[model samples]
Target: MTATRRAAILIGVFFLLTEIGAIAARLLYAPVLTIPGYVLGSGRDPLVYTGVLFEVLLVIAVVGTAVAAYPVLARHNRAVALAYVTARILEAAIITLGTLSLLTVLMLRQQPHAEPGALETVADALLALQDGTLLFGPGLALGIGSILLASLMYTSRLVPRGIAVLGLAGGAVITLSTVAVIFGLYGQFSAIGLVVALPVFVWEISLALWLIFKGFNTAALERMPRRSVDAAGAEVAS
Candidate 1:
């Protein structure tokens, strides 16, 4: 298999892994997020640790998906490719911050004697931080990054134009929803939020499967110059 095809497969695998990890983490953290002040004194639960682990894995997968596609994307337009990777990494870092906040809440809950009011206050603060990061990272950064990458794909014909359009439209919708969230027009994960975000979810999963199973269009790829790994480890195209 070609290196590009191998990278496409890797990206697809990690994209799915990211979704799985995110869902698992959400399931495990449901109690803490739903129950106010639950994080303050809720006895040590192994599930919290597991949730944090899944979140870390999600962060890794987020970055991995972007990096895997970077070389192929850079071949078309290096500037936008770099921007996309940077946006993804920034999103991952924000997610890591949210994960750390959750872990910290868990650590606080494990303490022997915690002041009830103080602990609750801290937990609330952390939770708020986590929510803010979720909106900023996944909603904004991810949306923008998807748009840039999808635009590149559309212009270069790396994937089907139809899929690219879906991505672009989905990205725009999510971004608009995020703005509404920031303005307090709707809650995250609300019916409206879900409705707005669903297209992007579909776009991403479809793109992942397509990349994994079909790879890029051969005619499209042929129109672009071929890139090879040189002895010095740089991509050199002739």
Candidate 2:
């Protein structure tokens, strides 16, 4: 297979990994996120550790999607492509921070505490940090990055226009919904949140499957190596 074809497959695989890792990590983190005083409770440590593993993998996958897709995107619009990568990095950094907070929660349980209820207080604060990161990382950064990448795809005609449209709508919806959540319109993961986020989820899955099976509209990218795309009013010989 050609290098571009292989890159498309790699991007698809990373997208699928991001999906699986996200779901697995969230479910595995239930005890810490939901149960009361999980830092004080015993058992289920293994599950939490497994969740950490999933999240670590998720962070890798999150960045992989942007990196794998960057070359082709840069050919079309270097500035937007760079912006997408930045957004993905921001998302991954926020997720790492959230994961670290959870790890700190677990660590707090092991260490001895002098003040009464201090463990619970600190654990609760860490848990809150985790949630806040989720709101900004997956909710905000993901949305912005999706829009940037999808807009490149849409304007460049590198993929089916219909798929690109879905991505555009999905990104806008999720970003707006996240803003509402930020204003206390609803809880993150509430019914409203799920409804607003569904378009983006579907968009990602569709894009992943398309890349894996059909690949990009290679006709448009036949000269991809030259970085001579005429989209977005940008042109370059680099």
Candidate 3:
């Protein structure tokens, strides 16, 4: 297989890995997230640790998808491809903040005879930080990046137009809905919020599977801009 094709496959794998890490970590973090004072009660530290590991890997995969896909995508539109990479990196950074907060909570819990009242307040603040990261990282950054990348794919026909349309639709819905939530029209964790997010979730999964099984459209590659002005005022083509 060509290197570009292999890169597409790797991107697909990273996409799936992100999903796995997100869901598994959420489930594993329930004890600390849901139970009151669990963080200081000799709680399920190991479980939360596993969740942290998953999230750390998730962050890696998030950046990997952008880095791996950039070269192939840049052939079509360098500006948009670069934007997508930037968005993914931003998303990863926000997620890293969330993960670090979780780690801090864990560290606080491990302290001998941790004070209950103070610990609870600090834990609540950390949880709020994680929630903010989720909202901005996945909800805003991912949504914007998806829209940009999907627009490129649609115009360039790198993948099926239908899949590209789905990506666009998903991004629009999630982004707009997130804004509504931010404005206090509804709670972010509400059922309505979940419903609106379905499209992006499906879009990601469908895109990942297509990349893994089908790779990029060859005709699209042939049609991509091959010549451009370099920084040194030299014309170059590949």
lDDT of 3 by residue, 111-136 (tens): 77767898989989999999999999
Clashing pairs in 2: none
Tens digits of per-residue lDDT for model 1, 166-197: 99999898988999999999899799998998
Ranking by lDDT: 3, 2, 1
What is the TM-score of each predicted model, taking all chains together?
A: 0.93, 0.93, 0.95
Residue lDDT tens for model 2, 128-219: 89999988998899999989988998988888999999999999999998899999999887999999988989989999999999898978
What local distance difference test score does each model get?
0.88, 0.89, 0.89
Weakest 10 consecutive residues of candidate 3 by summed lDDT: 37-46
Worst 10 residues of 1 by lDDT: 36-45
Clashing pairs in 3: none
Candidate with more favorable, higher lDDT: 1 or 3: 3
Q: Whose lDDT is higher: candidate 1's or candidate 2's?
A: 2
